[model samples]
Target: MKAINPKTKTNWEAIGVKPHIEIPQTNALDVAYKMALNEVKKSVSDEHQIKDINDKLEELSNSLPLKEK
Candidate 1:
């Protein structure tokens, strides 16, 4: 592993290695992070909802009268 220093960074333009590719100013990593965060939040919310539904079902089952065979 090598550490990259800003002062010793290679200049792609000076080396005549100009790539025709155009990069967007937007940070893709930040976008991905935000998307992942949102998914985690949604998953947590879904878990809570499922737990609440299960708790309600248990209560309902307990309130029902048992039938003898």
Candidate 2:
């Protein structure tokens, strides 16, 4: 590696400088992929439960009185 000189260059040393080793960066795509997988897992688990929730919401909405107020 070429030696860096403060007088000849900027006063900062920017190469190979890490305070601590960190985990590799995961970008937005990685986060989105994980979230989608989680949602799919939840949706696939006990489909009857999801159906029951939808049925209850439908019943509640149907029983409500609509007003133009």
Candidate 3:
């Protein structure tokens, strides 16, 4: 059996090859931690974007003239 290259999705090693490029496998806990970290990063990014949009909207509202009813 030959190990397949991840990038090109082809077998770079010759047939009956041993000790090819080793691909590190992650455990379930490691995968879950990475996924949670990504979600947290995305959430923080979304919060900052929302805050910026709100600030811009408030500035625009303040600049506009209001009329008495």
lDDT of 1 by residue, 1-69 (tens): 444447867454445544343233354344344445545555565777657655654554454343113
Candidates in order have lDDT scores of 0.48, 0.49, 0.50
**Estimated TM-score per prediction?**
0.30, 0.30, 0.30
Residue-by-residue lDDT tens digits, candidate 2, 1-69: 556666766333565545342323533344344445556557565877667655654554454443113
Error of 2 at 21 (Å): 49
Indicate which candidate wins on lDDT. 3
lDDT of 2: 0.49
Q: How do these models rank on lDDT, best leading?
A: 3, 2, 1
What's the lDDT for candidate 1?
0.48
Q: Which ten residues in a row have the lowest lDDT in candidate 1?
A: 60-69
TM value for model 1 = 0.30
Off by over 4 Å in 1: 1-45, 66-69
Candidate 2: where are CA atoms >4 Å away? 1-44, 66-69
After superposition on all C-alphas, the RMSD of every candidate to the true structure, in Å, is: 19.3, 16.2, 18.6
Candidate 3 achieves a global lDDT of 0.50
